[model samples]
Target: MSSTRVSGVVVTPVAFADPPLLNVVGVHQPYALRAIVQVQTDSGSVGLGETYADDAHLARLAAVADVLPGLDVYDLNGLRQRVSDVLRLDGSAQVGGMLAIQNPADVVLSPFEVALLDIQGRELGRPVADLLGGAVRTEVPFSAYLFYKWAAHPDREPDAWGAALDPDAIVTQARRMVEEYGFTAIKLKGGVFAPDEEIEAVKALAAAFPGHKLRIDPNGAWTPATSVRVAKELAGVIEYLEDPTPGIEGMAQVAGETDIPLATNMCVIAFDHLKPAVLADAVQVVLSDHHYWGGLQRSRLLAGICETFGLGLSMHSNSHLGISLAAMTHLAAATPNLTYACDTHYPWKTEDLIKPGALDFFDGSIRLPTNPGLGVELDEDALGRLHEQYLACGIRSRDDTSYMQTVQPDFTRNTSRW
Candidate 1:
């Protein structure tokens, strides 16, 4: 039924400007890395994909690309097999941070899978959402993903988002983001301060925007006791508590004590983790990241599993640019069970690799990109600039703790330190 074949593939690693967004691991690096994937087909159509650009992951992508040239775009099964065969138990390290799984095959397969889907959509003259079943909603809403931060990275000029190290400053940051993006929901990246202090910040956000839905993720910094204490303290103030502590047993312990539903991109990261998590009643909500879940189709499968298990579904994000945003928008638009506003770091970045006007936020939602394929194009000049930024930035991979130590000499990365 199909004639076009993959003619070639290009994986370009790029780094974009980032601010001092603090979290559980430490503060973000000055530059965030991503690999832009372009899958060119024999019929003269090109498809785009984006993913994490760690050195090991880049090597995996390059290995897959070697075998991709002659494969059929429709044969995503074949593509996945090639990735698995190449990466067979070699590099299954956790990517980016604590919430990730040790599945290099899926992490490696993600971008290439997205690119192939883009090619399929382009060949069929349909948006990627249609390939994923079809859009259940015309517009996809995203929450204001707020972070506790310094006004600037060390030794750099202050960025537009000023320091948000306390309750008042956090409230100020939330207000500015909501005002600019029209986001009706907000999530604070916590674990940077003491438990009560962070609780105070949540109360401040609640007071500032009484109409908005609120949530916080400490990235598993607290013990079960502290998690329950915060849950009871903010019982009606917040919608859900996310990753307050690590692992299923601890999460189940906290869930047992609180009525506020527990959510995570941590414990339930992989398919095998699902059964144990369900058995322990660890997580109520699972934040799906296609980048680590083996891309869109498998993400839909993940949604189905969550629905069947009576678990809520939402999307997770990383510090990324327009291409990742476009892919996320299409996937969210098509998934019926993804009811909550997805999380995004789109507002935090000062730069992007794709040309503008294809995606924009209105009332905190991006309307479905109806053009063929991913509905976004690479700005050649911008791509080159970001690639150069990648080269000269002198950072090979993301090491938030190491970067943070350059400023905070005694910085410790213990997850349950509190």
Candidate 2:
């Protein structure tokens, strides 16, 4: 009956593609594929975890395999502490900090802990939400990210226009996403696309999706002054502006200058990261992506802290695939102050990465899966196919910085990927 019996950890490459049936923007991406980590116990229950960064991350995880391979499987808390130990030793310091001696990498530990959490949930015979505490709600509302470039013709570069996006196209997609995909809330990609363009796009979207929540992500593409001007300009048009300024102080400036909620997603990765942003009252939404701030358990802890502060919590998605999506859904289900809808990345994709029905959206909402563990089964065949594709293309390097430069949307230099 013990869940702790150790089996082994297997990490593999997966080039997760969106369901081909759905196309956004114009790029039918095999977007950025992530490495999937599976932790299987002697009991035959397998837990899933994914590393979203590039291939170099796999090397980072390799450093800690020896430390984890034979550890007791049932002790989730101990596994968490072990991961912390690795991060302390191998993690990056900050802002281009050097890797410390024997410092186990933080990126590696993230997926490691995720796999362990998956295993823990299986052993406990409950969803990860139950393992965290309990569920606050079974279903979570969704907010769609409308990346203009993805829907535009390949020749139409929105970033080059310094902020101009196609008005007619914006209106068309807004209507389609809401009506076809059941998206109740939407976040328009702003900044690098011109300021006027961003404003116009929002105006068009607002007109189309009224009563539906709307927010703008400049990706920190504007100066504090520009952010203020724009936030006020779109006053009644948008619900909030995410990372308007380049950093935390800029967010405070924007928040102070306007009534629209200023969401700080890029500034905080953990509770400690919240200090500067919260002290400045720079944002209303505390957006934390599990990949950045460790994993699910830690993210939930941060959400609780936000609750105490009367701050909003929206889990930021890194345009990730199934496993991460499932994990986030569980966290959202458990959190108490989850008011705003977080971005749901799966339904927007062109392909089914995992089971066909891991998470389903109905009329703009996704229910926390009631199934055991993360409630979705993994598709080994699809994962393998994508993995081989990446390998064949010789694009499996862990160097995501290079990959990003090639594919990232045209957000101004000020845009931040939190």
Candidate 3:
């Protein structure tokens, strides 16, 4: 058994300098990615995890620190239960507590979860997936995200980014993902680029790879009206429209108006988030990101709701490396109702991941872990190198990244981190 008592947590930030370039929501900015939360314990055994997007994740981490000084490392269930009870007692909301530890909204949670699970696996001498519920399929299919733009007005910034992306770049990237890396499905960025131009691009790419499945995610950049119009235009060409509307109500309206399947990348948060939409039969597909929900369990909860509502399940891929992608692949493999292709785009991050046997993207599908507890060991050397790179870059801002050092959440003011 390991001898570490959890002491401190560290946040590492990474850059998406080589992000998939495309117009999104009218703006163009390199998609920024934050790394995992490194949990340092007394025994010198470090446990890594990801935090949720808000102060809640920080707060949750801080809360964990409060309880970590003496908590036994091997008792993960006890540790989780303690943290959960504290969250419930504090009335900080169910989503943020566990989710905070696993899916920090700002960073993809899979890396952090993998880190923790890796530590656990090492401690128990097993693979991460074994900790959850033995693996079902060691391989899972992936849909690479062709383009990304994350800004208030994302669709308007392609020219500002300077170099115009050649249409051939899309073909080459798609070809590499398929021919070189073996991806079966590809998701191109849409909704933010000029409507006509975007439609043309989708058409060209769809025709380019007739055998591969094609999907488009606007990232909630289009209005319901535009979504319906675009869906009609892309009908018989595109597979589904993701987050075509900014809101669930809009989705319902679009669902009523169109025959094409309306999927969602956003707007599906938790079980509660799915209720009204599911009841309305607005969503045909559900794309739940662990980064948004926090961990697999919460993601499972969201999936449970999707299954109950008879909605399709697919996960969103943040700009993550191998460790997180492998964890996500396992979750996808385990899920029963995951029919539509999943957005697991870690292959775009790089060829070599920081973990071993975490994922093997072969012929358009990634193999899930047959080992126990998230099933990938972190390459400490690689992690350290990446961490140092982040420190050298200014993007590692933990304090000044937000408008407020500590924004007062409008709800009941908890004296915690957020």
Candidate 4:
């Protein structure tokens, strides 16, 4: 192992423009928050990480950064303990709604873990995937993430994506995404409209792209009965039904009744969540997110557990830029059991902090970077500009339900609304 010590860590909170994509929670705000982490090593290498930049998360990250200097890059467990000891819970712990599986400490530790791994890779002169037991596959596949959206926010002008509220509009949107990015699979974000309307949209997607894999995630907006009904209706067409209902119990109920395999990034979110979910046979597939699962190494562990449990494995995504994408690509390339194409929100965002030619996709797959570390450099100017935007933009937290209130005055969050 290379004995590289971290010299310093810089945490920059940034905000970037986001499209008005609608989901079960609410519309995507004009600006989304993220923290860019840079870990400088004694060996003269800098490793990078990116994650949520909400006020609460940023506070934990800041605390961790304060103590990161002189820490060994290879001592991940020590890093975790250091972060756990430093973290003090505040209201920021409740960002993505109150899921029982959510852990604030994990949120703070994940990005730093990634940053350290990046440094380790650079010090050893190998790719991150090589450190994770080498690449099982050179190309990582990603699905086109489709959302039901308005032309724009209530008062703002429509962005280039336009409105995709109806079946025809959604079909058009998918066509554009596949044509531009060469995505072979599609995942539609549901739970915004009634189940029947969303079902029709999935049917339209199936008809438009015959033989292509398709999925619908409602973020658990339906009851078990409603979830089962939708699953049966689109039984043969969809590859898997994702988060049709909420929680392990609800998912298990729906799974018991439907042949369409159930998948989730919601119910089985953490490592401890695995046993109960597996025992109940609640989820047939687990959508792994490195940000929430701790980091790429932990994600590999999650994949191994899924394989041992006879469950399908795929990656999850939130709104993010190229750094996270590069980390995801390296992790996916190294994971042998990741059978399905991963989900990504990269196509939706118009702006990014990485250099212009950093990442690309062809035929739905990202060719793994051969260079040392993550193989993507941060664009200092873009980073500075986005940081300025974060300073000016006043979105301190992401409350999708509250944001939706502006568009639909009577909007209330009900998981079983349908």
Candidate 5:
């Protein structure tokens, strides 16, 4: 066996403070859930990966961790096979429904694949970007991802950002994000309000912050007709309109009617979705989330496919901490076609599980961390603290629709409500 042979794996579930960020699904939970994966190798290297901490996902992760020992770090294909074997026996069941993905193997395999990539980079004394390919850009730009949120969760004191229920509040949130993070591109999370209301919010953002690239994702809340109307109105104002409607056929309908490029994280997820999406000319941009796309190298393969089909590539995010951020920055740096500023929810959080000073943000982008193996040191104390919070938080899985229903009993998720 190689020195990079796996020794053990530790999967720790953690919870961190999350504001009530509203979206198509529902409001963000009181604390965002994530599983921190540490893959320890025989050579004394530990690589970190972050992923959704839904109870089912955590169970799958634990199962894989049990079988990871003795597998070589560089044997990514073998790793996938092992993950596939374990998951097949467990029976394929989706962890959650916030996003649609055809392959559960991709979901279960992602974090372990990322951890192995980290181990490989550490062993070779190179950045993950170098391993992907040499860095195409030293720093990666990220968009200010604005959400329509409440002042606070029910029965809780107002958090810092306050309530953003209207156009003015959205613009105010944009101002804060751009001012503090220096983000040049801005995106709004739509599908929570009426189409016209969301359109007005985008208009207000355009007036408030001229020259900033803007886009809105409605998460398939509107029908094709409504999506077309909104897209036409915001044609010149938005850089692109994301997931305005659902399904490849639905997106194709919207695409046929508008000049504005359509993008999606919903309909066009997974490798198998690529051919059908391209054939329909349904979307122009595909947002890559490594957590769902099977980690860094496989995500690179996705980039190549997007390039071949002449599609714009952008990265997607969840409520993540620094380890995921570091991995994202490195991947984006190496990806040539990922020219669009990627989306991030980083500025919304006040706490992190990584040690300070591993990454920096000043001008709408993050400079790559130069240290080996993802370049961010895990904070053991912080991990323990967050793990404690997770146990006390009592949220085993995310149920945003139910969470939103608690706040507004009448609330329900609608794919084409408008």
Candidate 6:
């Protein structure tokens, strides 16, 4: 193992323009926040990482930086303990809320872990995938992530992606994406409307693109009974029903009654969640995300546990840019049990911090980077501009429900509304 020690670490919070996409939670804000982490080694090599950029997360990352210097990049467990110590000292250990299920320390450790791996890969002259047990495939497939949205935010100028609320409008949105990205699978963000209306949307998609793998995730907004009803309605047409209801018991109840495979990013969110989820048979498939699952290595561990239990494995995503996409592609390419196409929000993003022409999709798949340490370079100019936006943008945290209430005064969160 290479023995290069980390010399310094820099974390920058940035904001990028996001389309007003709608999901079970609510509409996405105009701009989304993400923090870019750069870990510098004594050899003058810098490894990059990306994660959520809210105020709390940013504070946790700063604490991670304080404990990184003089640490060996190969000692990941030591890094984890240091991060935990910092969070405990700062009284930020209990940063869990409705949005994320893991403790704040675990969540914050993900980006630093990725960065350390990047540094190790660079020193050893290997690709990130090679560091993660080598590549099992050259290209990783991705699904078209469909969402409900207005032409624009309440009073803002319209985005390039026009309004897509009803069945016809959603079909048009899928066609546009398919024409450009060649995605063979589709995953719609559901629970925006009633279950019946959302069922029509899925039926319309099936008719529009026959034999395509289709999915709908309502983010656990439905009751078990309603979830079962929707699953029965779409039976053979839908590949899987994602997070239709909340909690492990609720998901298991729906899974018991339906033939459709139940997948979740909501219920089985962390490592501790695996035992109960597997024991209860709550989910057939677990959608893995490196940002929240500790990091790429831990995500690989997640794949192993799922495989041992005879469960399916897929990937999850958030509103992000090329760096995160590059990391996801590397990790996905290295994992053997990831049978389903991963989810990505790349199409909806118009701006990127990475150098132009470095990352692109072909046939709905991103090719694994062969260059050392992720093989993607950041655009300093773009990063600076986005950082400026982050400073000027008043929004520090993501609250889709609050943003939605600006248009609908009677909006309230009802997990079993359907």
For model 4, residues 25-61, the per-residue Cα lDDT tens digits are 7778888888999999888889999988878678788
Candidate 3 local Cα displacement, residue 218, angstroms: 1.2
RMSD, every candidate, angstroms = 1.0, 5.3, 7.7, 1.6, 1.3, 1.8
Worst 10 residues of 5 by lDDT: 89-98
Better of 2 and 5 by TM-score: 5
Misplaced by over 4 Å in model 6 are 89-98
- Ordered from best to worst lDDT, the candidate numbers read 1, 5, 4, 6, 2, 3
Assess candidate 6 and give its TM-score to the true structure: 0.97
- The residue-by-residue lDDT of candidate 2 on 217-272, one tens digit each, is 76676778888788778988877788776667777877887988878666665455
**Over the stretch 193-267, how does candidate 5's per-residue lDDT look in tens digits?**
899999999999999999999999988999999999998899899999999998999999999999999988888
Choose 3 or 4, whichever is better by TM-score. Answer: 4
Among these predictions, the greatest TM-score belongs to 1
TM per candidate: 0.98, 0.85, 0.76, 0.97, 0.98, 0.97
Q: List, residue by residue over 1-418, the lDDT tens digit for candidate 3.
A: 4465556666654433333243331222233344556666676666655433233444555555465456555555556665555454332322322122222231233334445665676567675556666556666777866763322222344322233244555676677667766766778866445566667767878888887778887666577777788889988887788877666788898899888888876566655567788877788988887665656656777778788778888887655566566667767776766766788656545433256555666777876665555555567677666656555545432221131212322322111111
Worst 10 residues of 1 by lDDT: 90-99
Per-residue lDDT of model 6, residues 113-171, tens digit only: 98888878777778899999999999899999999998997778999989999999999
lDDT measured at residue 20 in model 1 versus the true structure, 0 to 100: 95
Off by over 4 Å in 1: none
Clashes of each: 0, 27, 41, 0, 0, 0
Q: Which stretches in model 5 have alpha-carbon errors above 4 Å? A: 89-97
Instruction: Name the lDDT value of residue 246 in candidate 4.
Output: 89
Q: What is the lDDT of residue 147 in candidate 3?
A: 63
Output the better candidate (1/5) by TM-score. 1
TM-score of 1: 0.98
